[model samples]
Target: MQNTPENDHEQDAAPSKTRRKKDMHALQEIGEQLVELDPKKLNEFDLPEILLDAIHLARPMTKHGARRRQMQYIGRLMREVDMRPIQEKLDSWQQVSVHQTARLHQLERWRERLLTDEHALTEFAEKYPVADLQHLRLLIRNAHKEKAAEKPPKSFRLLFQALQATITEV
Candidate 1:
């Protein structure tokens, strides 16, 4: 059989249709993710008013069917807006969250070291030059005493707070 122009056009259209479907699915996934975000975080994105309203409306939807339908509506609205800025903001928020978690872990490690090792305080003060060496020393000593006496961990909490503040300022 001869390859006609009509046959070639049909073949090209088939791939385009599939690609459009994939794009729709991707937009729907982004919409679903937005719905799952807390309202405060959701407000960080520069979204269309209609899409933002849809998202807010979906939040109170307890019934699964209704929520799903609302999400589909959100996805439809998303297609009319530029998605690049939204995606970039989401990516940056995730990165900031990850950085905060890592910082918290580092502070915990420092607290543990201060409690377990005598030299840890010197190392911490050296690393965090702005830290009040004398205050940290007092807290660490009190925390150790509290641990040995099996008393409330007031000093331990204070030490952690001081470390957090010092690290955050840096």
Candidate 2:
């Protein structure tokens, strides 16, 4: 029951093994996420040649066992590279996509309000001083006419594009 040097060393070794396992599993999960990414987006990450080759090979793998083995190989390769930069690049890519989605939603909301409410134009112009109020008015009128006639939403699409441009410019 007495504290001993051997017992202290055993305690230290136990945590190191557990930590290594956890780190390995986390790396494997990251590798799996990398495999799921679009090839174009995957190319943006500066992965090692071996890991990149493994990912490319895994992409066409149909059999579950082959894919799993490839993923394990990718994880082992990942351990050789510094993961912090790769993690940061992935985080930034995700954030950019999220921001783009939010911006699209905002533009859609503005377009909807412009179609349904008369006061929305004034609000939009006030919020975006650089926007072309005259052009927006024309598009809104055309969009309303298209809606009444149940025609194709060409003007509505244009209005959405204008809104997007104006919002992004600001």
Best by lDDT: 2
TM-score of each model, paired residue for residue = 0.79, 0.84
Instruction: Note the Cα lDDT for every prediction shown.
Output: 0.89, 0.90
lDDT of 1 by residue, 1-170 (tens): 67899988888777577788898888888898898899888888888888999988988899999988997888889999899988888788889999989989999999999989989888887888999888988999999899999999999999999999998888
Model 1, residue pairs in steric clash:
none
Best by TM-score: 2
Task: Report the lDDT tens digits of candidate 2 across residue range 1-118.
Answer: 7789998888877767778889888898889889999989888887778788998888889999988888888889998989998888878888999998998998899999998899
lDDT of 1: 0.89
In model 1, where do residues sit more than 4 Å from their true spots?
1-21, 37-46
The ten-residue window of minimal lDDT in model 2 covers: 9-18
